[model samples]
Target chain A: MATVEFVEATRVYPGADRPAVDAFELQIADGEFLVLVGPSGCGKSTALRMIAGLEPVDAGRIRIGERDVTDLPPKNRDIAMVFQNYALYPHLSVAGNLGFALKAAGVAKEERTRRIRATAALLDLEPYLDRKPRMLSGGQRQRVAMGRAIVREPQVFLMDEPLSNLDAKLRVSTRTQIASLQRRLGVTTAYVTHDQVEAMTMGDRVAVLREGQLCQVDTPLALYERPETVFVAGFIGSPAMNLIEAPLEDGCARFGETVIPLSRAAARAAADEGATAVTVGFRPEALELRGDGEGFAITVDLVEELGADAYLYGTAVAPAVSGRIDATPTVTVVARLAPKGVPRRGEKVRLRIRDDAFHVFSTKTGRRLPD
Target chain B: MTATPPTRCASLPVSGRRSRRRGHAATGWLYASPTALFVLLLFVLPLFLVLRMSGSDWPLLAGNQGINVPDNFHEAVSHRFFRDSVVFTVKYTVLTTVILLALSLGLAVLVQESTRWKGLLRTSFLVPSALGLASASLLFYVLYSPLAGPFADLMRSWGFTFLGTPEGALWSTIFLIVWRYAGFYMLLMLVGLQSIPDEVYEAARIDGASRWQTFVGITLPLLRPTLTLTTVLCVTGSLLAFDQFYILTKGGPDNSTITIVQLIYNVAFQGQNDLGVAAALSVITLLALVIINIAQIRAFSRRADD
Candidate 1:
C-alpha cells in the first residue's frame, strides 16, 4: 500500500489545442479511496492513468510511496488496474487471469495457485475459475477483473469506471462491494467515474473535475454542502442544485418577488466583485412548499415520482415582479417534495428556500460567495 | 447509463414457426440454386469424370476403352517419379508452411507497429504479392540465371550457383515463393492482430508481463484461428507446388525437386500420356489434402480447448 501523488501533472495529445489534463495535482493517502469524477472528456481518466503510469507525466512528477516514478512503466509502478471493459484475456480461464500478475512476477506454482484460489473465493468466482471470460455473464466477468487485480495485491489499485459495463442493479451491488473490499485490503485506490452518485457513495474523498481542471476535492458531504464554485454546486447533486440569476438588493437576493435574506458575508462578497446581480442557489430538497401567494410561485411543468419522494420541475417568472415594466423571462427550477402531496403538472405552487440553505455566488465570477 | 432492454423475440405456434422456417429454407435454396449449379458443372461433374477415368482404361488421345479400376491405381503408385515426388512434396510443404508462417508473423508484427513508417513498410512488403505466381516464378528464373541475373556477380563472388544443385534448386524455389506470397499471409495475420483489443495489452503490461511473455501468452493463443487458416493455406499451396518448379527447374537437378502435381501433369499431357494414372494421382493428392487439413484443424482446436 502506498500513497499516490500527482504534482502538476499535465497531458496534451498531439494536434490538440489544449492539454487534456492540465496541471492536475492531488495526493491520495495510503488506504484512501479517492474518486475522480467528471463529465465525458473531462480528463478524469487521464489523471488516474497518470498515477498508474499508463500515461506519461509530461510536465510534473508522480510518486507512489516514496519513489519518483514519472518515467517508469506501468508494471514497475506496483499498481493494478481494472479497465472499464474488464480487459480480461479472453483466451485464459478465470484462474489463469487471476494468477497472471503473480506468474509474471515468477511466483512459485504452489503459491500462485493459493493466491488465485483465495482471490476466487473472495470474489465468489471459484465456480467459474475453469471458465473462459466469454463464458461468464457480465457481472461475473467484472468480478474476474476485480479478482485479477486483487490477486496481485499491489501497492495501489486503479479502476477506470469498472462498473460502467454492468447492468444497473449489478452496478449498485458491486459498487458497495468494491468500497468494502478496498477498505478491507487497505490499498490506496484511485477510481474514475462520470457517475456523481457513485463518486459520492464510494469515495473516501471526492475530487470533482471539469474541462481538465480540479474544481473541488472534499468529503462527499462537505462537497455537497459547501461546493467552492458554482460549477460544483450545479454538478454534484442529482436533479442538481437550482441556481438562478437574481438582482442583488440592499442586503438580499431576489427570486420573483420573494426576497431571500443573505448573510452579510455573501452580500459583501458580491460587492467586492462589483457585481449588481448574484446567483442564488439551493438544493432541490432545500425548497419548502408554502401556502398559495406566500412565496415565489412556480408553475409545475413536470413531476418525477420515486416511491417515497417526488421532484417538481417547473418554470418561475424571472425577476421584475415589482413591476419594472421591462420584459421578464421564465427560469426553470426544480424542488423535491413528498410523493403523497406532489402537485400535478401545471399547478402553481408557492415555494420558499430555507434561510440558511441559500448558496450565493457573484454573477461576474463563477466562484461561490462567502458564508 | 440506462440502456434499453433487449426486445424479446415474438413467439409463434410451434407448427407455424416450423412451417415458416421451412419457407425460409426454400427461399435460401432458391437464392443458392445458381451457385449450386455452377459448382455441380464446374467441380462435381469434373470430379466424377476424373473418378470414372481413373477407374477405366482411358488414354489421353483415345478416350475410355474399358474398366481398369485397380490397374490404374497400381500403375500410378508404381510410377518411377511417384515415390520421389511424394517425398519431395511433403518435405517442401512442411518447410514452406513453417517458414512462411514464422516469417509472415514477423512481418505482420513489424507492419503493425505504430511508427510513422508503418504505411510505407506495409505497402512495400505487400507489393510482391501483387505479382502473379507464374509471373513471379518466371521473374525469379531470370534472376536465378548465372548469365543474366543480378545476383550473378554475388553468386560468383560466393562461388555458389543458385540452381546448379538439388539443395540450391529447392531453396531458390522456396525463396521465390516467400517473396511472392509472404505479404498475403502477413495481411491475414495483420487482420487477426487488429481484432485483439488494445485494452488487453494494457492489462498485460500492468500485470508486469515482459514483451516475450505477452507475445507467447496473449498474442499467439488469440491468433490461433488465423494461424490455422494460414498454415492450411500454405501447406495446401505448397503440396500443389507446380508453377514455380515447372518454370524454374522443370523438375531437374536429377529430378530431386519433382512434385506430385508436376508428375500428374507429366502423366496426363507430356511423357506418359495416360489420363487414368493422372486422375488416380490427383485423387490421391486431394484425399491427402483433406486428411491433412482436418488433422491440422483438430490439433489446433484441441490445444485451444485444453
Candidate 2:
C-alpha cells in the first residue's frame, strides 16, 4: 500500500474558460479509502483521472508513493482503474480479463493463473470464469472489473463511479462488498461518485467538490454535523439541510416572529466579516415539534411517510416581527417526525430548533460562522 | 360463469389476432417483394442462363446447336492457358489480400490516433477508391508505358523497368490495385476501430499493456468481423482481376499475368470465340468463390465460439 498526493493539481480543457479541476490539493494516507463527492460537472472525475494519469495535469504535480507520476503515462503509474461501465474486454473470458494486467506486467504464467483463481474466488466469479463479459450480468461484470484490479495488486486503485451501471439494489450490495474488500486488502483507493450517501458509506474521509474547487474534506459525520461552508451543509444530507436568510437584530438572527439567539463567537465572527445578516441551517432531524405556545408555527404542505419515520415538508408562517416587512417570503422547512404521529397536510404545527444544532453562516460570503 | 365469459372474450380476440398477424405478414412480404423480384430477375435468371450456356455448344456469333453435356467443361478444363490462369489468379489473390489488409490496417491505426488533419488524411486516402476501376486501370496503363510515360526515364536512371517483364508487370499491377483499393478497406477498418470504446484502451493502458500488445490482444480480436469482411472482399475482388491486367499488361510478358477472368474473356472474344467454354469457366469461378467464402466464415465463427 502507498499514499497518493496531489499538490495543487489542475486540469483545463482546450478552449474552455475555466479549469475542470482547479488547484486540487489532497494527501491520502496509506490504505485509506478517500472519496471525491460532488454533483455532475464538478470535476470530481477529472481529479480522479488526474491521479490515474489518464487526464493530463496542466498546472501541478501528483505523486504516487514517492514517485512523481504527473508526467508519467498511466501504465508506469502502478495504478489500476475500475471504470463506470466496467470496461471488461468483451472478447476475453472472465479469467482472461482478470489475468490481463498480470500478463501485461510480465508475471509468470503459473503465478498469473494462481492470482486469477484467487481473485475469482474472492469475487465469487469462478462459476463464470470461461464466460465472456457479454455473458455476465451487470453485477457479475462489475465484480470481474473489480477482480481485474485486485489481481494486479497495484499500489493504488482508482474507481470512477464504478457502481453506477448496476441496478439500485445491486449498487447498494456491490458498494458494501467493495468497501469491505478494500478494507480486507488495505489498498489506497480514491473513488469518485455523485451520490453523497455512497461517498459517506464508502470513504474513510469524503472530500466535497463544487464547480472545480475543493469545498471541504472531512469525516462523513463531521461534514454532516459541521460543514465549513453553506454549500456542504446543503449538499451532504438526503433531505438537504434547510437554510434561512434572516437579518441579525440585537445579536439575534431573526426569522419571522421567532428570534434565534446566536452564540457570541458566531456573532463576533459575523461582525468581523462585516455581515449584517446570516444564513441559518438546520437538519430535518434537528427540528422538534412543540406545543403551539412554545415554538414557531409551520403550515404543513406535504408529508412523506417512510414507515419508520415521516418527514413534514412545510412553510414557516410566523407572524411578522416588528421593523421587519410582512411581505418577505416565508422559508420552507422539512422536519423529521415519528411515523406514528404524522400530521395531516394543511395542519399547523409548532416546531423548535434544538440547541446547538443549527449552523450560522455569513450571508455575503456563504462561509460558516465560527462558534 | 367466470370461465365461460373469459373463454368467450379470448376466442373473439384470438380470431381477430390471427387475422391481424396474417395481414401483418402479408404486408411484410409486400414490402419485400421488390427486392426479391430484382434478385430473381438479375441474379437467378443470369445464373441459370450461364448454366445452360455452359452445357451447350454455343459460339459467340452462332446459335446454340443443343446441350453438349461435359464437352464445354472438358474443353475449358483442358485448355493449355486455363490452368496457368487459375494458378496465377490464386497467387495474385493471396498476395493482394495480404498486402492490402496489412497496409489498410496500419494506415487506419495511424490515422485513428491523430486528432489534427484526420479528415484531410481520410479524404485523401479514400479518393482513389472513388475512381472507377476501369478508369483507374486506363490511367495506370499510360503511367506504366515504357515509351511515353513520364517515369520511364527516371526509372531507367534508377535501374528499374516497371511493367517491362513478367515479375515487374505483375508487381506493378499489384501496386496499382493496392493504391486503388487500400483506402476502401481502410475505411472499413476505421469504422471498426472507432466503434471500440475509449475506456477499453484506458483500461488496457492502466493494465500496463504496450501498444503492440493491446493491438494484438484487444484490437484484432474485437475487429474480427470487419477483418473477415475486408479479407473476403479483397480475395474475391482480386480473383476477378481483369481490367488492370487487360489495360496495362494485356496478359503480356508471355501471359504470366493472365487471370482466370482474362482467360475467359480471351476464349469468348479473341480465341475460338467459344461462349460455351467462357460460360463453363464463369461457373467454375463462382463455385470457387462460394467455397472460399464459406470456409472463411466457418473459420471466423469457430474462433468466435472459442
Candidate 3:
C-alpha cells in the first residue's frame, strides 16, 4: 500500500473560465480509506480522477509513495478504479473481467486464474465465473467491479460512487463490505461520493468539498462535533443543522423570544468583522424538547415518524425577534426527538439548545467565528 | 394534477382486451401496409417474374416461347465466361470485405482518437458516401481513361494503365469501391465505437491496459455486431459487382474482367439475348448469397454465445 498525496492539485477544463478542481490539497495516509465527498459538480470526482491519473493535474504535484507521478500514465501509477456504473466489460465473463488487469500487466495465465478465482470467492461470485456481465444482477456486477480492482493488488484503489447504482438497502450493506474489504486488503483507497452518509460511514477521514475547494477534512466525529464553516455545519448532518440567522445584541443572538449568549471569542470575532449578525448552527439531535418553554417557539409544519427516530420540522411562528426586521427572516428548523415526543403538525413547541451543542459562524463571511 | 402511472394491458377485462388487441392489430396493419405493398410490387412480383422467365424461352424481343427450363439452366451453366466470372467475383468479394472492414475500422479509430479534428475528419470521410455508386463508378471510369482525363498525363509518363490486365482492372475497381463506400462503413464503425461508454475506457486505463490490448480485448469484441453488419453488406455488394466494370472495362482487355452480374447482362441483352439464361443465372446467384449470409450470421452468433 502507498500513501497518496495531492499538493495544490488543480484542473481547468478546456475553454472554461475557471478551474474545475481549484488547488485541492489533501494527504491520505498509507492504508487509509479517505473519501472525497461533496455535492454534485463540486470537484470531488475530479480530484479522485486526478489521483487515478485519468484527468491531468494541470497545476500541482501528485505523489504515490514518494514518487512524483504527475506525468506518469495510469498503468505506471499502479492504480485500479471502480467506476460509478461498475463498467464491467459487457463482453467478458466474470472470470475474464477479474483477470483482465492481471493479463494486461503480463502476469502468467495460471497466476491470473488463481488471483481471479480467489477474488471471485472473496466476493461470493464463484457460481458466476462463466456468466457474462449482462447475466448478473446489479449487486453481482458491482461486486465484480470491486473484484476487478482487488485482484490487481494495486498500490491504491480509486472508487467513484461505486455503490450509487445499488438499491438503497444494498448500498448500505455493500458500503460496509467495501469498507471492511479495504481494511483487510489495506489498500490506500480514495472513494468519491455525493452522499454524505456514505462518506461519514465509510471514510477513515472524509474531505468535504464545495465549489472546487475543501470546506473541511476530518474524522467523522470531529466533523460532526465541530464544523469549520456554516456550509460544513449544514452539510454534515441528516435533516441538516438548524441554522438561524440572528442579529447580535449585547453579546447575545436573538431568535424569536429567546436570547442565546455567544461565546466571548465568537462575540469578539463578530465585532471585529464589524458584523451585526451571526448564524447559530445546532444539530437536530442537540435540541431538547421542553414543557417549561425555556427556548424559542416554532410552529410544527410537519412531523416525520421514521420508526425509532422521529423529527419535527417547523418554522418560527413569528419572525425571530422583530428588532432585526430588515427582511423579516423566517427560519425553518428541524429537531430530532424521542419518538413518543413528536408533536402533531400545526402545534407550537419549544426547543432549548443543549450546552456546547451549538456552532457559531460569522454571517458576513460564512466562515466559523472563533469560539 | 397528480401524475398517474400508465394502466397496463393486464388490468383490462377480457372483452376490453379483445377490443384493445383488435385496435392494436389495426394500427399495426395500417403502419405496415405501405412497406407490404412496396415489397409485393417491387420485390416479390419481380422475383416471381424472374423465376418464371428462368423456366421459359423468354427471349429479349420475343414473348414467352413455351417452357425451356432445362435448356436455360444448361446454357447458363455452360457459358464460356461463367467459371471465370464466378472466380473473379469470389476474389473481389474476399478482397473487398477484408480491405473495407480494416480501412473503415482504422479510419474510425483515427477519427475517434483525434480530438481537435474529429468533426472535420468525420465530415470529410462521410462526404464521399453521398455520391451515388454508379455516379462514383462513372467518375472513376473517366479518371482511369488515359484519353481525356487528368490522370492521362501521369499514366503516359509512368506507362501505367489502371485497367490494362485482369488483375489491374480488378484492383482498380476495388479501389474505386473503397473510395466510394469507405466513409459509409466508417460511419457505421464510428457509431459502434461511440456506443461503448467512456467509463469502460477509463476502467481499462486504470486496469493498466495498453492501447493495443484495449483495442483487441475491449473494442473488437464489443464491436462484433457492427462488424458482422459491415462485412455482410460489403460481401453482398461486392459479390453483385456490376457498375464499375460495366463503366470502366466493359468486360474488355481480352474479356478478363467479366463478373457474374456482367455475365447475366451479356446473356440477356449483349450477345445471346436470352432472358431465360440471365434469369437462371440470377436465381443461382441469389441462392448462393442467401446461403453465404446465413452461414456468416450463424458463425457470428455461435462465437458470441461461446
RMSD of each: 5.9, 2.7, 4.8
Model 1 lDDT tens row, B1-306: 234332222334666789999999999999999999999999999999999988989999999999977899999999989999999999999888899899999999998986888999899889999999989999999999988999999989889899989999999999999988899999999999999999999999999999999999999999999999999889989999999999999998899999999999999999679999899999988899999999999999999998
- Clash-forming residue pairs, model 1: none
lDDT of 3 by residue, B44-132 (tens): 99999999999999989997999976889888889989999999889989998999999999999999999999999999999989998
Stretches of candidate 1 off by over 4 Å are A320-328, B1-30, B154-159
The estimated TM-scores of all candidates read 0.94, 0.95, 0.95
Top DockQ model? 2
What's the CA RMSD of model 3 in angstroms? 4.8
State the TM-score for model 1: 0.94
* Regions of model 3 farther than 4 Å from truth: A317-328, B1-31
Query: By DockQ, is 1 or 3 better?
Result: 3
lDDT, model 1, position A47: 89
Query: Considering DockQ, where higher is better, how would the candidates rank from best to worst?
Result: 2, 3, 1
- Candidate 2 on B1-306: residue-level lDDT in tens? 769998999899999999999999999999999999999999999999999999999999987979999999999999999889999999999999999999999999988989898889889999999999889988888787766787888877887778878889989999999999989999999999988999999999999999989999999999999999998889889999999999988898888999999999999999689999999999999999999999998999799889
CAPRI verdict on model 1?
A: medium
Query: Order of candidates by lDDT, top first?
Result: 2, 1, 3
Which candidate model has the greater DockQ, 2 or 3?
2
